[model samples]
Target: MRMALRALPLAFALAPLTAALTPIDALAQPNPAKMTFFITSAGLGNGADLGGLAGADQHCAMLAKAAGAGEHIWHAYLSTSATDGKPAVNARDRIGTGPWYNATGVMIAQSVAHLHDSTANTGKQTSLDEKGGMVNGRGDTPNTHDILTGSTPDGRAYPPGTDTTCNNWTSSGDGSARVGHHDRQGGGEFPTSWNAAHPSRGCSQDNLKASGGAALFYCFGIN
Candidate 1:
């Protein structure tokens, strides 16, 4: 993993603290999964209908299982417009409210959609040009891209630690800070660390390359 300059010193300080702890005690401790994470495009489509709530219950069940969620809830939503200025809304508006639920049929993640002209693709699973949106035309289409926020199953946000940027901050004309190629085909995990630092911007397709389409995920805290 590429260590950030600011995080390096903190990482070193924490190492010794960990060493002082008992191995068995640490090993036995359960690593709690946070409630927030970027849902895949496939997750959104499979989870909900355009405006109906019937499909979401089933979808959240599947999401909880796939994500190894413990007493946690998962959710999905649709976009009202296309990145290319096309009318995305159709008959699926009634099911806009999510079918949120827990492991035992208790509702957790709620469903909602935001309309924006973002160039970020909420589908696909590969790198692409900064301008290309989510990759649905290609193989393995995703359902939608969402900005992650809210409390965990137990209700907690991932702690802030590093700077996160999609496509290395290229989409909005931010200069490149990292060396990896932009994931144009979507289905990439939004950086939790970056989300903590730049919550106002949410997740964007700014730095992603334009040759291939990709989605953006952003993490944030529940109000």
Candidate 2:
């Protein structure tokens, strides 16, 4: 019994050392079954077009399903301005009353109010992708810190005249979309705003790429 107790202490001491050497892909990607928040591992590959909000939501769901997180209803963190026949939508309104968690089970926000406020725990480290991988950010070889948001700093849609959503996420070649810095750095009206940093140069694949983005966006589980 004494020998067993001594072994337990030694084993506990070595556990962290063992974990330190574990490959990122092997153990870094943790329980997606409980994930409630993630940046899409991949985009629709159409710049800011995103096939509109429905298509973006579908993309989120598909990626979540692939990552074993399909049990929840996923929504893209996007907003649409009021148009001729359509009412405006808020990105904050679509996602559930938060307490959202990342793929590694790290909480991003405790509530919707918290998420849009200064107290939310979101940034390069906590804002992980669907597979718990870090999205490239400022100072990375090729920066992809600009995350599509299409919402204001408060997470609401812009007024009717603005083309913040890239023509409601349909016209990828003409207008521009508002984007956030997932790394919570860089230049903008609200430079550190995780949901509304600045507008993209334009809504094309090349433009987004050049502007430090790869057409990636945030996703949240509503159920």
Candidate 3:
């Protein structure tokens, strides 16, 4: 049994390396192809003017395609207030029925109700980008923690009286857009609210940057 005894040592030596590469918990690692929810890695770069919901949805589809998850239809988690006699569009309705997971396979929420609940698992850790990378939070340099949502705490659009959507997400000049803190920790009236934290300072890129934002938002798969 000398040959068998000699091979045992090599097997033991390779075990740790394999384990390190493939992590003991497979569910905790990146699984882009199966991801259903993620924060946008980057914004449309035009501040809050996402070319309306159509352009924002297009961005989501483009990003999903690049992540290899294009089979599923994607939608930006954004809401629109009534403008030009059009009815408001709710963010919750756009994302479809829930139960979404991040790129790392971590469940962000079980349903639409759960997504707005305080216990949703969409904190700085689980609210990962499509690349399975964490977005900057409070203590990080430049602090890009703000995520544009334009909806209230319950994922519905605000009343048309005030400008909480950057003029229905078409202006980058003087209007403000409602933003949420993705990290769930910041200085806002609802600092811990993941979808309805505060309003942005302005719609331009520089104005958004002033309030610790980079024009980012969330995306969810509908199918």
Candidate 4:
């Protein structure tokens, strides 16, 4: 009886601590099903200049890590144009070969071809963020539907000519970036294109907003 009394206080003291840790423990467990696709809830503040492709990839990895989905290799869906003798890079080539899913366990695409197909399973409905939250679209308040892709409608690098990638995602000052409509809504040409809507007037964050964007992009897990 004396021993039981002594243990009672200890149990009571530890109960709240264990209760506080319950949710954290649940979140810390690596999801066995895992996440494979997400639209970044935010972006690097320097406009479309994601410090080039490497920096963009790092951003994807960082966001995935924060969301407890860091086990898989993450890649940003952004294209780079060849300039100053450098070779061009396609956004399609960087992401892994498909079968991506949103945080809510919803599959986005089964393969690369399927991802770019007109019937792709992605859009405002499936293209959720790391938290499985819906991003605002063309008809939503503020209308942040434009997502940065920098690739053509076919997911290839733009031909050498006018700056179609904010100087290959390195300039947030004076260059322009190609954007897409995640909502598949109005953009005049390619209004229904999910990954290729139109271009930004300039590379600044405000400029991206002018075209109905919040400087966001898509991230995919390769592994």
- Per-candidate TM vs. native? 0.24, 0.89, 0.90, 0.84
Clashes of 3: 0
List the global CA lDDT of all models.
Answer: 0.28, 0.91, 0.91, 0.85
Q: Report how far off residue 159 is in candidate 2 (Å).
A: 1.0
The Cα error of candidate 3 at residue 112, in Å, is 0.5
Model 3, 99-192: lDDT tens per residue?
8999988888899999988889988988989888899989999898999999999999999899998987788899999999999999887999
Q: Tell me how many residue pairs clash in candidate 1.
A: 45
Which one is best on TM-score?
3
Mind sharing the TM-score for model 3?
Answer: 0.90
* Models ranked on lDDT: 2, 3, 4, 1
Backbone clashes for every candidate come to: 45, 0, 0, 0
Looking at model 2, report the run of 10 residues with the lowest lDDT sum: 21-30
Q: Residue 106 in model 1: shift from native, Å? A: 24
C-alpha positional error of residue 131 in candidate 4 after TM-score superposition, expressed in Å: 0.9
Give lDDT: candidate 4, residue 170. Answer: 85
* Shift of residue 175 alpha carbon in model 1, Å: 32
lDDT of 2 by residue, 1-223 (tens): 9899989989999999888777654546678888999998777888999999999999999999999999999999999989989899999999999789999887889999999889899999989999888999999978999999899988999988779999888877999999999999999788898989999999999999998999999999998
Better of 1 and 3 by lDDT: 3
- Please give the distance, in angstroms, between residue 6's alpha carbon in candidate 4 and its true position after superposition: 47
